[model samples]
Target: MTESWWRDAVIYQIYPRSFADANGDGIGDLPGVRTRLPYLRDLGVDAVWLSPFYLSPQADAGYDVADYRTVDPIFGTVEDARGLVADAHDLGLRVIVDLVPNHSSDQHAWFRQALAEGPGSPLRERYHFRDGRGAEGELPPNDWPSIFGGPAWTRVPDGQWYLHLFAPEQPDFNWDHPAVADEFRTILRFWLDLGVDGFRVDVAHGLVKEAGLPSLGRATEWHLLDVGESPCFDRDGVHDIYRSWRAVLDEYPGERIAVAEAWAPTLDRVADYVRPDELHQAFNFSYLATGWDVESQRTMIDASLDAMGRVGAPATWTLSNHDVVRHTTRLLQRNEGDVAGRKPVEVDPVAGLRRARAASLLLLALPGSAYLYQGEELGLPEVIDLPPEVRQDPAFHRATGQDGYRDGCRVPLPWSGATAPYGFGPDGGPSWLPQPASWAHLSVEAQEGVPGSTLSMYREALALRHKTLTEADSLCWVDTAEGILTFTRGAGFTCTVNMTDRPIEIPHPGVLLIGSGPFDATGDSVTLPPDTTAWWSN
Candidate 1:
């Protein structure tokens, strides 16, 4: 089997709206990302996975792409995107752009034409346009609910209903339509020719649905995250779509790859998306959703590695993303990283930051690729106190939105300076979402040279990862005390994590290379503090 760069690559995901803003527009743009390429290079990431910046109305941020080929004016022009990709390459950094294939913005040219040409138009065939089911055709065709909330079907003035698995502004594409498939192939080639390394396919498991638009028929509220055998998600036919995409990726040189943002019921199903003839990697959401304990993390990690290994694919690990509450905050919750259940409890920010640092080391030491969400290196917590008026997440507006609010994690990153905007924009304009005043101390500039700072820790760990752990593919568990986990990679590298509230003694003979927090070592024995982790060279 041919080796792939994505197998062990460290990919950093940048949420464009919050990354950095140029032209002082209060929104991050491709130009902004261009100017910041050196920063990412310095951080030691092999590639950057950019969230959507394509032409869109911003209904679901940029996920609702209106034109796959065009860049939205708010985020800059097509020239700017090309320039950004070129700039990233100059820094020896690969670029992975997001591809929202499952749906497109309602304002897209094809969708607009479908709406204007009425019910029987051939253009309407490209989308899931169907007649309503009631006597007067007043009801939605099925019981499927929008991921953002409410019914998944939207009615047109012509008495027909169109399916929107997400928001109404985003209409699902009919992959059964040859034209839809052909259009995406053209879109893929256009970006590939422009030199993008790969795509992080949005909703990779959702292009196809059951033949009959059947209802789930459950009384409880619907959640998009609920995986397993569902008529609308992870259908058996999505694999064929990926096979065609893999062929497109193979046409490009330098081993261009595609990563799936697929959410299936199990790691086994997730692995299917990355089979030999499919994508290069699929996000291991099952691992991300695991709790922050020794046993829970260990179980999920084992299951992920085993499942992906069976298919000859490397496992991927990530802690935070644009959609979920930041791990820094999630860890502090009483639920220990379960964002789904709404339980109110006091949060200990200090402990959360400590645990987050430890978690990062544990993830980086694993035998596969790792994804870092922007600002995580600085230990930024989710901005949970955004004013109601400033909230813009579509889910927040809907009564049935699975996650009550996601804007907390999408707040603009703190770059430098004090006060709001935090140097996010060159003109010091207001940000799209407000930044917490406390983040002034967490700005990249503040942590750039500070020893023991979160950013400094990430830089050191990632640098060491390249030199020592990149090719260390084998992992063996080392027996240790309860609440403490120890593992060895290859011959000379060891990682020990202390997950309990009490310190644990490490009996290994080695020099500590990195520690998440301060610890004590006397002679041959070292004590790891609570919620701390350490990497050592034996």
Candidate 2:
């Protein structure tokens, strides 16, 4: 209930590689971001969180850090980062950077040194290492799977194996080691010292593992990430890690926040990541994972609220991220609370963008800060046409012929469709990732201020929220009949959404505050155009 700067903040997440390439090297850089600072400010967000620009081998798209203190040559130098922070601050927008402490690239000097030497190496304690003492190391230690679809352990070729919760390239750090903890704390201090606002931590929940590294229970399905039957690390020690990080954060004087990317099914564990001193927010992916149903949204919200009540941590809701399909695609999957077990109903092609816009409104309406991935406001959809030659995402590379990888969501941001460079750079120059044909129409420059365009609608939506952030208490959901979601926002304000194409009666409401299509309100009911929605505020 206490007022915090991030409480009502609208955060924009920018993946630098795909954001914009100022140099036309086919990769987006800090200067490109610097060029786009005004664009972000125009979006009316409280802060901009840059995904990772640290020195890396690009093994996992910069999540695999080789050096924590400097920026990768592709993204520019530490000076560029400083300039970005300065530019963002000058524009009244807070600057946030991603912190990937859970793992480091296998090519990192520390890992290389650890591989070359034994426990006495300077980087020895930075990672998890174990010796296979008996039977020629047949059944070495425990069963664990790498998040990227292999055993969590890989042979050092030194007759030993180390743990990697994610990709083999991303070796998990050993939080049990005090030296490692100090190193990450130092990394945090280094960035904060740069006048940066805060961090968006990668996998904060899995920071600390079970000390014993016990066996996971019996399982039928064997996912490479599910190291179950080997050990369940999402236990008590996580809190210790958070508490330690919190100590480091406390040492800093100014307003700083941390958001964790935890994807636990239950909210209790999610809440742990956001404990007061631990993290400021955790992604409420329940909505992202939720099917479109009145009951689904209601139940997820209630559970999230209850969990927040227990831990006193504010909850975050997200419809889409760089990791999954966009919300518009998900909306196509949601039905009007009617029958299922039939063919997947095709979303009205005409209303697809509107659904995406409506989803944006839904996320902003929630209690916690809204995290918008780059280009979501432009009604960006997943990219599918990139040939394997142009694909750089590990998710796709690992999936080998898998249809649903994250690269689609991680495509190059479209600045202008008509421009040959797609607003990233010159046509002849390289783009880190390829832009699809549809991007031509769904670009920022093309749609800005255009009536019925996703860009303008998003601007209006954010402006509306900025006008009413302090009066959020008036925001409350009312009735859900006939697949319609009607809610009241602050005081007597009410909004009703009829998610179907066929006209349907809406619950009682005053006048329509805003609408996406034709709607008529009667005494106690309203008729909504097919595949349309409306908002009301009295």
Candidate 3:
């Protein structure tokens, strides 16, 4: 194992709309994020990956980019982004912006030109156009289900069809078209030249539509993208698209990383995205959404590492993010089922922290970069019964209960519930999402001194991780036995997490650098208390 800055880096993702609001308005803006740089710097993340803040109609909450080069009025202006980049750099944090090359908002000038020009037009080719594909181009080319819901293809008013793998508003780009690839290259250079370190590519795996555009293996229900068969994205030659990006990134130094949002089933294909000439790392989502069964987790971790171990880049791991339920909430749901047949997972936010620490130790000890979503350090629980009326995520709206999509993972960062805006907005006027009443007790300020609070434990764990920052490229040697997951980060650093409620023994020990409360793994054998974890640097 060797040292790599990206491997050791802690990248924090900020969903600007929910992070903080400087304006009296309910929504968060760039100014709000600027005010929070000190907080983020205090947290000690190596980088900040800002989600899309580009100009948009908010139809998809910034994912639908109307103009890649400009900031949405709701968020701020181009000058504000410049200031953000400068401020983040001053804080010793690198910056990465969202690169959504797959599609653009219908309001984008390209899409508007496509609407204006019929099929085969220059801009028309920027998006997928297959004649005689759907219900008069309304239905998709196959039975694949869109992640948001419905068929992946839709018809234009001009009687031609375009493909959109996620949302109708997000029309899939025809990466095959040289013009489409050229457009994204320009977009990439636009931001890179603007001083962004790199990009967190949106749906990176799906950039290349399958050449054949095959139909679903089964003909019942929604489109097949969800269940496979529709290989439009993540198809072969996808690397070509990435290679193109890589060639551009190579022009710059600093090892600028491109974290691909690779959501695929097989590891071999996912591994392809991280080849040295392509993406730097793809999201290892299997672990992020795996069932908590120990065997399942071990296999997922081992399988992912084995896959990437054969490749050029390190595999990244994330417990939860903006698109998934908080790991704490998910664990609670699994441990305590049946709350009036709905499940008892909804309200058990208190018990999540210690377990979260144990889990964090479990993930951080693995190979590759560990993504810490905003508020994850606080062991934030999913807001229960988040009413659909206030649901801002387009994934939830499109899925409509089909799959437990993104809404649970996204909630207003609880600055202070007793405060006017829960500490998220200016003058505490209104929050985009209703702040939970429990936030009063769960805020960062409230948990700073409280022993055993999730907030404190997370900060401690992060500090401990800082000690092993040099071991980024280390191999993950895992030992799953005796109700614990033990692994060594490189040769001199070994860590173990006792997930069970009872104390467990350890195989070995060097130095007790850090651990959750009630833990002891001394001299060949020791006890790890219920809900405890330990780290060593020796």
Candidate 4:
């Protein structure tokens, strides 16, 4: 692997609580992940990005970090985390863990001290604490709403309010405090010493806020993250934080990198997070948010590559994550938004899966790194029918409607077995989020060696990408029929995706290497079925 292996790597995301369970406790832990190293290595990913497993009360599903250095008891001990990193390294795969510097669990020692010591304590300065605005000081300091739901400011018994951009259980940190910034640098070194390769900075755009903690004036909308008007998120000051962190990562031996989960409104602003002296890569969310249309996809692709290239950073592509609806279900519709509390919309499952497969091929064939969410390789769709009583997402509990609930995508992965637990745990214990009966067929064992299964397709494409596409430094567009996209990578590699209604002949003639769906070839042309993508090598 090269110093900048992440430039064109395929990284797999493992949502710890739902990945695999070694203990009969029904939740996945670090030891379980260590045991699955071979599976990921075999799947052909260059790296594995583990979501938060830090000590927490599980509010916001571990995104609320109580201790940056301690592993949660449910996830495993510190020794287990060390072992997972060592084992992953032995498999020749890089490890990238989640770092949530924007907020901390309310149960964190700093938050506890701030609460006990009242408004005047130095600990209180590390967080946002202010007096309420009403005549009796009863109203919140500001009208900003939590991204989860309701008010972002929570008042304490002592008449002071603390800000939390997310759920109340997760308090936003004050980046202006020198101690807060210094503390995160210490935390970064703690993991780097353990031989981990990098960190995925969660909410990377939200470290700083506008000077004044002013009211947003209007009812808050969660989709406003990229609007740049919010006082709480994506402020320009956040880049300084990354610049300092980059200096720390540079001191290490391997080219340890930082990938930002930033949601800036424009590609140029998102690029700011990955400027030569700052973080390494920022997720190209504009591409993920785009609907399945040629024009929309093409525009976002061009914009992302252009902006990130200007900054000398590789663009990162992602299709799904633990927080939102899976793309298989998302691409079935013409709209792009969360699928929580809304009435279930009808979709042709067959068609949705087909489009998802095609989209995967198109994304992998692009010129930068790609992230694969857990369970997506098996063609898992969102489990929208979760019973209300068992749902544990903070978004569902705080909001009146389904706009924020993300539990459907966090169901435990099925390894083997035909029943409910599906080998997720040793004793087949009940999963934290119930798996749909339909998942019996989507289990890893069910699709492992099946030639045309989604799992097989991903493995083959990823292997091909590592062998052929990784070294291609440029791509040239080839004119194609309306609704079809054709581009060549280097001189011999061509990728074509047909989005039109009818089968269209591939413009470039080359030996068929792999495809998302069936294709037919003659001496001069190849016919691609509708809603399919193919890779060819001349």
Give the per-residue lDDT of model 4 (tens digit) for 295-324.
Answer: 888888888899999999988888888776
* Colliding residue pairs in candidate 1: none
Ten residues in sequence with the least summed lDDT for candidate 2: 337-346
Candidate 3, 324-405: lDDT as tens digits: 6677776556643211112214544555666766777677667677898888877677776778788766655564444434
Model 1 per-residue lDDT tens digits across residues 153-207? 9999999999998889999999999999999999999999999999999999999
Looking at model 3, residue 135 earns an lDDT score of 48
Clashes of 2: 13
- Top candidate when judged by lDDT against the true structure: 1
The order of the candidates by TM-score, greatest first, is: 1, 4, 2, 3
Clashes of each: 0, 13, 13, 2
Report the C-alpha lDDT of model 2 over 441-491, residue by residue, as the tens digit.
888888888887777767776787777546246346776677777666667
Better TM-score candidate (2, 4): 4
TM-score of 3: 0.90
Number of the candidate with higher lDDT, 1 or 4:
1
Candidate with better lDDT, 1 vs 3: 1
Locate the minimum summed-lDDT window of 10 residues in model 3. Answer: 335-344
Q: Is candidate 2 or candidate 4 better by lDDT?
A: 4
